[model samples]
Target: MSSNTTQMSIVCISEMKNSKRVAVEEEIIGMVKLNPFLYERKHEMYKNKCMRNKKFNELGKKLNVPAQQLKARWRTLKDKFFQEFKAELIPSGSADEAVKSKWKWMERLRFLENIYTPVDNSPCSSLNISKTVQELQQNMTSLVDRAKIIAEPSVPKSAAQLFFESLAKQTEEAELTPAEFCNLQIEILKALKAASIPNYLQMFCLQQI
Candidate 1:
């Protein structure tokens, strides 16, 4: 073939490949939309992928389908789900609303999963929030104490004093009497518990905090 004809052929081949990919993607999405079982499996895979779980193949196996096919289309369906998820998050004319509050990454995920999940319900929604928050705070406090011990050899006494002083300042600014503060903490814990946050997820949230 002549040079121009060869270049045209290559371009045509590339276009054909792209067309095929697009068609396959559309087909996969169509299948997921129509099949509840497939969508459920896809949801499990997506959640496992997000957590960087080592045994994600287990989810694929649970689907009872060809492994290769499940692996190939899982990502595409997740992308489509997230796209629809973004639309649900901030529909037309809600750009201002989305920007109004700074949302954390996991918080956004929780928001999306809560509204619509391919499976029955959001996984994190089962967590006991009040207990999780309390444990998280206690863990953080323990961590800080350990850090103090670890750093005592290197950190100056004045610097240590300054850090504790800052914490005290924060406590003062909270402006609640000791009884009121305890009551407030109890109320916060109750609200969290009511949220139905699961234990493992509560730890995950604490680690993030």
Candidate 2:
């Protein structure tokens, strides 16, 4: 009876977490609709900082809140939104159902994971792939270093275009919106689909007000 009760408690906790995540996501969606600038590309905000600041100031006056506070709230919401976004990418069902072969890009993931895994040098003759994990780790470190440059608070004039192009090349796709591009880039940098990157570039653009 105790074991069963403990299992039920764990399930209840998981359900509660999911429910809270859903509510937060709904709030974030509403907020984005209320302020479209909250969802705009980092490049757009960077190029039009002055105009964006004026708009924020106007909205701030009406809401009786400082523009900085509004900006900070948006950043917090954005982080939570992306966290949920990453969580949803995880496969929840059976293996066959989890394998989404319809997407060409996803088909490459298995092959890439294999390449990223290094053969082990362990004494066992069974051939372990754990030893060479360092190779992939080093590659991810390099990618993160490059991504950090683009994600810096003081981004350059053409930094957005450059980052987008790099992501497209890395993912072998194009025409992704800023959010999509950022998601893919973050996945590549971390070598996992569930890692979330700090939205410093977006926040940097927003806080310019």
TM-scores of all models?
0.31, 0.33
Task: Give the residue spans of candidate 1 off by over 4 A.
Answer: 1-16, 41-70, 83-95, 98-121, 130-209
Per-model C-alpha lDDT, please? 0.38, 0.40
Among residues 3 or more apart in sequence or in different chains, the pairs in candidate 1 whose N, CA or C atoms overlap within 3 Å are 126-197, 126-198, 127-196, 127-197, 127-198, 128-197, 128-198, 130-193
Give the top-scoring candidate (TM-score): 2
> lDDT by residue for model 2 over 99-151, one digit each (tens)?
33343223222222221222332121122211233343444333433554554
What's the true lDDT of residue 59 in model 1?
Answer: 37
Q: Distance (Å) between predicted and true CA of 204, model 2?
A: 32
Deviating ranges (above 4 Å) for candidate 2 = 1-38, 42-46, 93-182, 185-209
Measured on C-alpha atoms, candidate 1 has an lDDT of 0.38
Best by lDDT: 2
State the lDDT at 110 in candidate 1: 33
